[model samples]
Target: MKYSLVASLILQGSLVLGTRDLQPVHFKAPSALHFRDIVRNDTYDFGCRPIAHPTEDGQFTLHALLTESQIAHLTEEYEDTDLSIHRPSEKRAAAATAPIGSGDRFSGGTIAPIGLGTKASGSTISSILNVKEISSAVQGLVSTYGVTTLNLPYKTFNGATQFAAYVGAGTDKSQYHLYLSAGVHARERGGPDNLIYWISDLLAASKAGSGLTYGKKTYTNAQVKSVLAAGIVFFPLVNPDGVTYDQSSGSLWRKNRNTKSGSSGDSIGVDINRNFDFLWNFKKYFDPSEAPASTSPSSETFYGTAAASEPETKNHVSIYDSFPKIRWFMDIHSAAGDILYSWGDDDDQTTSTTMNFLNSAYDGKRGPVGDSAYKEYIPSVDLTNIKTAATAAVNAMKAVGGRSYITQQAVGLYPTSGASDDYSFSRFWAKSGVNKVYGYTMEFGYSTNFYPTLTEFNQNILDTNAGFMDWALAAISVGLT
Candidate 1:
């Protein structure tokens, strides 16, 4: 009944607040163009008079009421890029030479097809997996390969469950782990689906007695053996209810399904990304007046009632506690084409050498040179690796799909509080002083919000797979000088 009410309201474009009073209330956006996470200053007249607040990047975060026709118009704009259109594959490699002092150029062999349900060209929603399907696929991998499925105890507002897969749990528990998560914002469907494709490729490589290869670098069977021993953990979908809702209603819902105390009015759900406990609403990077995240429940970036208020937020905390061996973490999102490192609140973090390295590397440069700068790393983070592994990953992604993903500090892009990557890094580095786990956030794609068509979606998955693999390698190779 709760689900039906929301869905019905979305279809009707109006909600009743009192007897004989119909309000033109804009609820969660019904399409990608209206995604609440987007920072836009332009206000098209939607009924109920949309409200706007200033955000960074010279844009405004909006909460608006739109009529049914307005939503249709917005959706038509989003569909401008057809999903069914096939995109030609990019050239297999970059120019076959090196530029002196410009940095190491990645040369690589042709990409091998390790099928995880993407076509050589074009994209299709049919290839993507739902929550139940994801669970089944994970179980299949567990049975066929040595992967282990770990279930989280949390359920979404619609009673949907969440789970994860562990690739090396049977090995020594002391081995470090690489943690990757996607689908934190339900409408960003690519991240979760991309993880499945990546996991499938890794499992396939493991089964075939071959190592995974990204660009020119191939992890030989020996390196593969060692990396597998180190462990890989993946959370494919963090907000199942929200994903289900988006796919069903064609709405770009960015938060969890938590609603206002049994009321079906206005917007519901907290932005899970802003609900983490660390530095939550920290005045420097986040104040309700200045940040996209809000104290009100109706906001797309709504911070929950209190820090770590939602089950999803608590579940991530449990994950952090469960894995003391976690050496690298990435919270993947889409449509930005960026590989972001932590200290998300600011570009210059007092404690981060990595932050300093990145700010200098790509501060003013734009386009390819700036995009390649993610490889810059400070030696103090790890004596064994003065070279950052992120550059190789970024380059590999470019080489595969020609998507230029810039690497930088998280705050280099925008101010965020209670970000998962920041919290993950803070858990080990700031609070525990371990400083072993290096955290990251990979914002994939070069398009608008999370509503890419199948063609764009498949390309994004292909483009990002290389970077994901590189990050996994870096996680396992930490502290090796």
Candidate 2:
């Protein structure tokens, strides 16, 4: 808390966040007791702020990207405490990571990106979709499945016109109760592929009246029809410009390609995920000790100049206006295997309705983790529905026969502001007469392993597709209307 506040003051001068050539590393903390203090630093980047998972013996393992200097400083400080840091090598990263696709895989929208679930067993995806392939795959979906695509009103800084699609909902936009999206973070590769392929599986299975199998987890023809009947509205590839830069430069870029903030280096773009209107002005809504989102442009989680400032964020928000009855939403991302629920800016509470995000009574008093000051109010029914749906998705991911996943509230070890999941859920209370929507984030793949190997990429598709199936099924079970 002390370090974060001091850093915040220094940032008042509009200093650019310091840049570094960071490498992913694992820190085995002595226990969650020690891990909590370390994560509260706010200076350290625990990718997506997931809780440190337990090791077989008893210790907790945390993943982060750190510069050599930061690593050295922490090493010196925590050497006596047995806080061990281990560098990972899937044969030194590059060798293991699947290459980004060089040319159009979808043949300029002529062919759809078929998912692994629809193919015979032992299928594989050759590479991560290139920027062009991302669009072409979406085009293929429209061409092949009769999906409706609408051009989002806002154009990105790079002059790209973004769009979103809706399918399996017949003609009425309001019938689209379930929403799934991806490519919010440029370097979280395969997220778009995971969502696109899952859509294809649903369409194909519904057409053929056959079952869908993702490894050991299988959905019958009836289950497939039921999920499709729930309706799906998806915006795949939310940040096109960022994905373009990340794909071309091989940099771990996580923001839009907007240079309004700064012209060069890390000063280039805004973190679109952190630009949502929910608690966007973290300095006003959160406590001094909490750094939910950074004010520095060069920081990866920069909240941007204003809420919904970026055109991409506006396009994302525009979806709710178009499809007002959306009851469930899931934003897809990678490198952290978690299914995150609502209340990212603080802990969730069922009793304190007046202390919620929509209530100005708790301004400047929120964001502390274990505190008595304020807690975000979520009704008991809403909490049960979200948790039940999250658990179903997590169990389905494990049943895919590849890996395991956990479901938790979005605020795990630290808080965040303007995140998509929180903003989607907060809409009900923040705006009058808005439909009640349950929001979720599916963080797939290995921790900090942004560029998964081809094997892992294919495995990720299977794991997440099964997860989507159960998530949507559970959402329907809980009630879509």
TM-score of every candidate: 0.68, 0.93
Residue lDDT tens for model 2, 1-481: 6997777556433332344467898889767556666676655666655467777898888888887888898888888777888898767565577889888978888897788777898988898888788788889888888888989999999999998999887999888899888999988989998998999888888888888999999999999999988889999989999898777666677888798888877778988888999999988889887888888887777789999999999999999999989999999998788899987988889996788887777889988887889888899999999999999999999999898899878887578899999999989888899998899988999998887888999999999999999999999999999
The number of clashing residue pairs in model 2 is 0
**Candidate 1 residue spans exceeding 4 A from truth:** 1-126, 169-172, 211-223, 283-289, 349-387, 433-435
Give the candidate number with the greatest TM-score: 2
Tens-place lDDT per residue, model 1, 202-306, is: 767666777655433345656556656667778888877777665655445567878852234335677788888755654433323234245666555667878
Give RMSD to native, each candidate. Answer: 12.7, 6.9
Candidate 2 deviant stretches above 4 angstroms: 1-20, 36-43, 89-95
Candidate 2: clashing pairs of residues: none
What is the lDDT of every predicted structure here? 0.56, 0.86
